[model samples]
Target: MKSVFRKILLLFITVCTLFVVLKWDLIRYGWQQARGQIAIMYNAEPLAHFLENPSYPDSLKAKIKLVEKVKTFANAELGFSSESQYEKMFDQKGKELMWVVTAALPYSLESYKWNFPVLGEVSYKGFFIEKEAIKLAQQLTKKGYDVRVRTASAWSTLGWLNDPLLSNVLNLSNGRLAELILHELTHDEIFIKDSIEFNENLASFFGQEFTKKFFKKQLERYASELYDYLLHLEDRHTLNKFVRNYLPRFDSLYQKIEGLSTIEKENQKFYLIEKFKQDLRNQKFKNPKYTDFIKSEIDVNNAFLLSYKRYSGHQELLERKLQTQFDGDIGKMLDFYQKNYDSL
Candidate 1:
């Protein structure tokens, strides 16, 4: 009995050691990310201090105040959390906290998901270092994934940590700043696990609508910036509409191409991309931003579509539903999303 007990003990310890050894990389990733979040939570300084700094630029000071205003309005008018998240701010000293890498197959719209603790399977992975993000992209690229890396200006911890307005977005127009603040706040309001698409799209929906109303309410104060934002939004709408029509058609065509050799498929793909670019160029947009976009080489792949779709998919249908059924009331829309969150 003593010999059996000893053997069992040895086996258990060996198994445990092997498990830890095998999972060390995953463990380190989770630990480092959690530590980074905790550090940010602790490093944040009160917004009042930043405002009181006489040496700070007047423009940035006003943007910081705008953060508070948006947070207050979200709490009082939009019924979002009255948490003390936006009470503090952090200046990253030109260092970004993370880069988001989104990956998807070349032919499918499904995002390549990475499973992490707490957040579950997220469609995009955030790396504290750009090199790490690039490493991931390279891995995904090796697997035939089309990956896109975007520098994140800000992110919320879903009420788990104090989210601060970063210095990265201090230069955005007042209207754009408010839009970003509301966007992050909405994430805290209704970020369901395993429903990032719903969470982001819902946030984008509220962000745009709430910005329209928020700026309209203060239009007299921010008229010029409001015009800039409105024009920006108009271009965004136009671009989204074009993407919605073109990509699905492109995907359909790609699927229908039978007996095409690998080289032929490559040629067809480039042809489609060029044609889409031409179509975008044909449509004249007032925003120079959109004009610049059409001039670039736009790659249409699963990653491209997946990333865009998360923030803007079903937007037209959703807006129509809210406008027609909910009478365009923002509160009603929030209530509807909460009730039918999963279905979305």
Candidate 2:
């Protein structure tokens, strides 16, 4: 019996050793990233540090005050997690915090996923450097993957790490800044693993609603910002509706075209894509940004839509549910989802 137990322990150790050897690079990269972030946190000065500085301009002070106000409101009014982040600030000196790289098959909406320890699987990967992300994107493109890299001004570690405010977005408009702060906080407060779409969409919904409510309290002062935000939401909703309706059509084309010869299917897909773009061009969005986005988006592969879809797909239905069932109270909506997102 003791011999058998020794054999089992030896085998387990062997397996662990092999796993470590196989994943050494991944482990090293993750550790490097974690250490870098930890260093930043260690060096980051608390908000009080800056406030006490004589060189801190009034404009910067006001911005920090607004962030504090938003944080207070998120806790006292919205009933989001009482857990706190955004307690410190890191100025990255005109650089984005990270760049996100997303890849997909040329003709499929499914994204290439990367699995990391603790984080599980995520559809997109973030690199602290731009050239590295571009290189990876180019490599994936060469392998026939539709790849995209976008600058990410901010992101959350889902409470695993202290995410500090960075200089990259310090110049954001007051409304946008508040929205971003609220959005990131929501992620810190509650997150589901291996669910990028759900996480992003929920955060975005809160950001929009919170900003609107925040601005509405001072409508006389925020009228223009509020108007612009509403118009953007209207445009986004229209775009989401258009995409959701067309998604099935795209799926059908993929299915039906498979029966055709490869050459013929390729030709048909091209024609369909062009048709999709032409149809989207005619959409009457309240904000021209949506029109321009569709134009740029159609030029890329189906994978181009993955992240956008994750963040906005079926958002109109969600908005309606919030209004009809939750009485548009974000706290109630959040509570319902907190208890029910898995079923969803």
**For candidate 2, lDDT tens digit of each residue in 206-296?**
8888888877876897798788877877787777677667777767887787667868877887887787778878889866667677667
lDDT of 1 by residue, 1-344 (tens): 99999999999999999988988878877777778777776887888888899998888898888888888888878887845777877788877788899998665556898786676778988877778789889988998877898888888877666777678788777777888888888887778778788788888988988888887778798778779888888888888887777768766866866467868877877788777778878877897767887887776666776776888887887899889999988788888776765431
lDDT of 2 at 178: 86
User: What TM-score number comes out for model 2?
Assistant: 0.84
Which regions of candidate 2 deviate over 4 angstroms? 1-13, 49-60, 218-223, 260-263, 281-299, 340-344
Q: What are the runs in model 1 whose C-alpha is more than 4 Å off?
A: 1-22, 297-300, 339-344
TM-score of 1: 0.90
lDDT agreement with native, every candidate: 0.80, 0.77
Which candidate number has the best TM-score?
1
Reference-based lDDT, residue 98, model 1: 80
Q: Give the clashing pairs for model 1.
A: none
